[model samples]
Target: MHNLRRIRKHLGITQKALGDGIGCTQGNVYHYERGQTLLPEMAGRLIAYAARDFGLVLTYDHIYGSAQLPPVAMAEVVNRG
Candidate 1:
């Protein structure tokens, strides 16, 4: 089962807050939590790191279940902008 909602609630932050933390909208957070749209691995790691900056720890298991998160290349991401 997806656990973004659980983790967000535990951290006492709203969907909008988490979305802002990760540069997404509240709608995106809602869909991601409900499985309407899959949260990409890179984006998941970004969110995890953002949450960490806020003193919360999240992981692939917490966000993407038992599956492993694929490695992300910072170069490609930086070049996209």
Candidate 2:
């Protein structure tokens, strides 16, 4: 969980910043980063945006402690829109 937060911080983005990018609230970002909740779709969007926009390779292991988020493709599509 701490690692997750560290990654977000490493990106030089505040919770509010991230939320703004993803159409969420800062409190929601805090909850997700802190492991208080799991938002699979939003997490995938964030990872995809980070990778495509910021050159950050945030795999599922980094974001969700698993290597099985298939939402990357969907994220890409959404990003294009």
Candidate 3:
């Protein structure tokens, strides 16, 4: 299972909100959370959105369930940008 759902919930981002930020629909986000593989373009968009909109950085491992996220400070994320 992808960690999209967990990441979103961890950041307190609603599906609709995340979808909107990434230029997709809530249904698409729902499907992605449920196990659909995200296309490269969509994955890139999602990564960009997390950083730009929420000051959160995300990696492929976080999205694909290969690794767990460490506690990240917003200040560090913003500074990295």
What lDDT would each prediction earn against the true structure?
0.60, 0.65, 0.77
* Model 1 lowest lDDT segment of ten: 72-81
- Per-residue alpha-carbon lDDT of model 1 for 33-58, expressed as tens digits? 78664557635754665445444445
Per-model TM-score on C-alpha atoms: 0.60, 0.66, 0.77
Report how far off residue 24 is in candidate 2 (Å): 0.7
| Runs in model 2 lying further than 4 Å from the true structure | 1-3, 66-81
Model 1 global lDDT (CA atoms, 0 to 1):
0.60
Q: Can you write out model 2's per-residue Cα lDDT over 1-81, one digit (the tens) per residue?
A: 424576566566677867777778899878877677656787678777677656667776877664433323444434434
Q: What is the C-alpha lDDT profile of model 3 across 1-81, one tens digit per residue?
A: 567788777666679887887899999999998889888788788789877766677888788767767565666444434
* Superior candidate under TM-score, 1 versus 3: 3
Q: Which predicted model would earn the best TM-score?
A: 3
Task: Decide which is better by lDDT, 1 or 3.
Answer: 3
Of models 2 and 3, which has the larger lDDT? 3
Per-residue error for 9 in candidate 1, Å, reads 0.4
Question: For candidate 1, what is the TM-score?
Answer: 0.60
